[model samples]
Target chain A: MHTSKVLVHNRDRSEIESEENYLPLNVLRLSKRFGGIHALNEVTFNIEEKSIISLIGPNGAGKTTFINVVTGTYPPEAGMIYFQGQNITGLPAHKIASLGIGRTFQLQELFLSLTVLENAMVGCHTRGRAGMFAAGLRIHPAKADEKRLREEAMENLKMIGLEQRASDSISSLPLGERKLVGMARALGMRPKLLMLDEPVAGLAAHEIENLVRLIHSLIDRGLTLFIVEHNMPFVMSISERVIVLDEGFKIAEGPPDDVRANEKVIKAYLGE
Target chain B: MKNSEIDRTHIPFIIMIAVIILLPIIIPSAYIISVMVFVAVYGVLALGMGILIGHAGLFSLAHPVWFGLGAYISGILAARGWVSPGIGIIVSAFFVALISYIIGAPILRLRGYYLACATFALLLIAQIAGGQLTNITGGHEGLLGIPPLSLGGFVFQTDLHYYFLSWALCIGCFWFCSNLIHSRVGRAIRSFHDSEIASKSMGVNIPKYKLQLFILTSVMASLAGSIFCFYLCFTVPSFFGFHLLVELLMMIVIGGIGSIQGPLIGSFVILWLRELIHIYFGKIFPVMTGEVDSIFFGILIIIVLIFMPRGLAGWVEQSFNLGRRTYAYFKGPGA
Candidate 1:
């Protein structure tokens, strides 16, 4: 299959060696089939720390399915996943999250009843070491931890330009601000890897521009980002590498420039 | 809508604690003191219910099972000299927590209508046990000679003394539940209420939090029940019947579900209304009867539900927000 397709700029040996400098996150022979349909078929990829990777595809192209598998939302029927050289296959979503994987939903799932600060506090659950009894009783350690947590939450909110909205209930926030809050919550978890599902989808161009800047800021802070997005321009501008899938099969893999020019990717889109 | 300047969360608690503490001094009657004592007891029970229903958003009416079980357990144990009042109270709370954990394990797995029905059935079963188990429970006649709770040589015999004791316990419970709602567990409970799937995905063990809240609330309810039995120096299985269960449930609703103030406000409103109607109508207008008061309270509850769906706490919060707006308006555009 590799020979049948025209080789589109495969990495040189020196470049591949340099790329492997950081620990590689491995998705091994992953396959997920729902009855007669295969959402992801024997797809394998490696993501290194401090790199921005984009998963691009047409509708029903299993971009989301791949994200789900990586994030442990969907347990792969056959495969292994290793994060930082440790096996994380078949771990539950929250366990995966606690293991330094953070995620934002396609549609934001916020604590509508709680204030913005409180919503971010929920994300700090894993980092908290206070026992429930101690917290309930407001013991000295619990109080100190709470003060630190509130400060951390505030710092994250400030980072997202939402410090003023801290006490405001999340239900009242606009969609763009809510998206920012979701990102802030994920940030509060102190993740080594952050997966964002369409962070700028359904936003105005200006909002999308703002989100692009925010993503870049997070990347600058040394967060590994895997973004699933439909806005090709936004993905192309920031993504260091791109993986294209069509009908659950890897169609092309290269730099954004190469992937953008690939005939197979163009054909997959045109066929839709 | 972005008025995040003020912290109004604890205002209701402050006002409530003030009103309850000053109630006896203002009322100035032995009979009224007795009524206030009952209000404090009701406050304790409602506070427990408030934690589960208000904070955790678990719709349960199993107050009587916990309350009655604690009352009977502590009463029987203390009366038999198995333990002193202090130890018995501690043991009662512990036993209630244990029982709630066992019962909640099975019942909490069921949600919505199934949960309500299951707990309702549990209440019925407790009521039946109270009626049929004559040898141990004294059946409908109830257990008698429940010794008064004493800290040393000092027993709470008078309504004045019991009222102080009850309010002290009420304060302790209020502090505990308030602190809990602000804790990580409290947030987890609220998280489950808001979004169970999201909570699970956040590394919160859903069943563990639910059971923890259930057991905690159960222990609180039973502690109140045991204290009530001790204070009255009399116990009857019927004292913790379905009627009391409904009343306790109504307290959470009338006060405001999910708000900490709901239970205390609900208990006062309910108990006061009942007493007012009982004294004035039953004594003066004999034909009105206590049954009329039940109907009256029912109408009031319906009205509250129709107009103020968020209950009294919501109303107070609305007005408080309005007050802030008015203040801002008076401050003018320049300020």
Candidate 2:
């Protein structure tokens, strides 16, 4: 085991070397309120290049709110979000996704009626360069692009070990399989930034282990990940930096060891 | 059914062409051919309704208003000789798409019963306006002496000729709609229908896709309306009435909502039932009772709903699924 602390907040020679060519990916500062409840307050976070960051909190800690605001699912009324160093506060979700960010839902939102392959192909929406009218007319270029999309979609399914099940309807799949299919669909977009909302939620322990290893493998391939999870042990083992929230306010931020030992985070979980 | 699964939509169109080709060969009745022409016309109209209500989950009630708009616009243009019949059809479909794009944006924001009410009222308003505005629509008497559709140099004069033309148009429209339903946007529409909020989070441009589909379906409806005027050589206010709108819905529900073949199948079944009811009941029942077609239609809708909530198209799919499962089970230990 590599028992080393890669302090993301601190600067080292290699870290500075990497940062010199670093492009700003995503920066968020948000405070959201609903009537008498402060759902999220003065929350600020940054996702750097090639990092796997975990957001951990108890129930109602607004972990999802943070993801929603950053991904353009929910517009934050009080603060701004910057993607790729440019302000992208209130752009539509699809526009934000087209800018290289992709996501999967907590409950696994697969197109249930469509086949697994077709569902994955929907991710190629922005990537397809050919016009729909040309495709309808079956022009040579559009036909070629469609063939390419089908092949790429199959390749993506194979990435998640679902290539054999490509023709099966999503509704025929079990819950764990559907979750994997959802991840496969997001991966089909060839996204630079992937935000997974509770990717392993409700899975069996064995399934969770498989998923964690897969995610680690993906991160090693240079994809950046921001995950919202309640699985603290997994978060501590894999995440470089852990951010803890209680009632929508950031309570602590440090290395996994520091976050795991933080008294306030311990209190927040124990109290809930 | 195995090979048919990939092109299940082509089944009804193929069956329809076969029937139309055989009808003249076997029956040789001019009146029946005219009735067959209505079936083709209704089939086209029902497909437009099916695309919106079935595939897109729009539950629109303003479909007939678009259809009527097409009829009146094309009728007025061709009747006055201001434009050729072909140009009249194009202009009519264009206005319907344009108007739906403008009005559908705000109105489609409402869902379910409220949406139904808003669109139903819209159809009612168009019907009334068409009747009241004598100068433009020709009011109660309707537009008469609309020019016949001509292709190249040949005029479509006979009922047999019109039947072939109408069915050809129906085939073209069906092909267009089936292609749309299989397109990428069609998949997005189905995803939106499954879960609107989830689709939103997944970066689907929901409102834009919804509005575009609405306009597209309206244009289809208008084209069907244009075809109707071409066949009839005249247009009447009653032809654009509310009952026809309800009938179109009935055809879609009986056939299958989202499945491409359902609309044509449902319309064929309904038209045959109506003919059967009229032949029997018109002879047996008293004049005070009107025609028994309405009652038969009501019963058919209820029976189909009770037995097949997914509609006839769904039933066809279910059977195919069962067959596939059985085949897989035999091929392996367990499927």
Which candidate number would show the highest TM-score if scored against the true structure?
2
Compared with the true structure, model 1 gives a TM-score of 0.87
What count of clashes does model 2 give?
Answer: 0
Kept native contacts, fraction for each prediction: 0.43, 0.31
Candidate 1 colliding pairs, count: 2
Local accuracy of candidate 2 as per-residue lDDT tens digits, A1-272: 12222232222323433554544354434777777777788777777767888899999898888777777877876665666555677888888877778888888877777789988877766566554355445566566667777888888888788899999988889888899988887876778788888888788989888888888878877788888898777888878888898898999988899988889999999974
Question: What's model 2's TM-score?
Answer: 0.90
TM-score each candidate: 0.87, 0.90
Candidate 1 on A125-220: residue-level lDDT in tens? 677767667776789767777777788888989988999999999988999999988888888779888888888888888988888888888888
User: Residue B315 deviation, candidate 2, in Å?
Assistant: 1.6
- Give each model's whole-structure lDDT: 0.81, 0.79
DockQ of each: 0.41, 0.35
lDDT of 1: 0.81
Q: Which ten residues in a row have the lowest lDDT in candidate 2 chain B?
A: B286-295
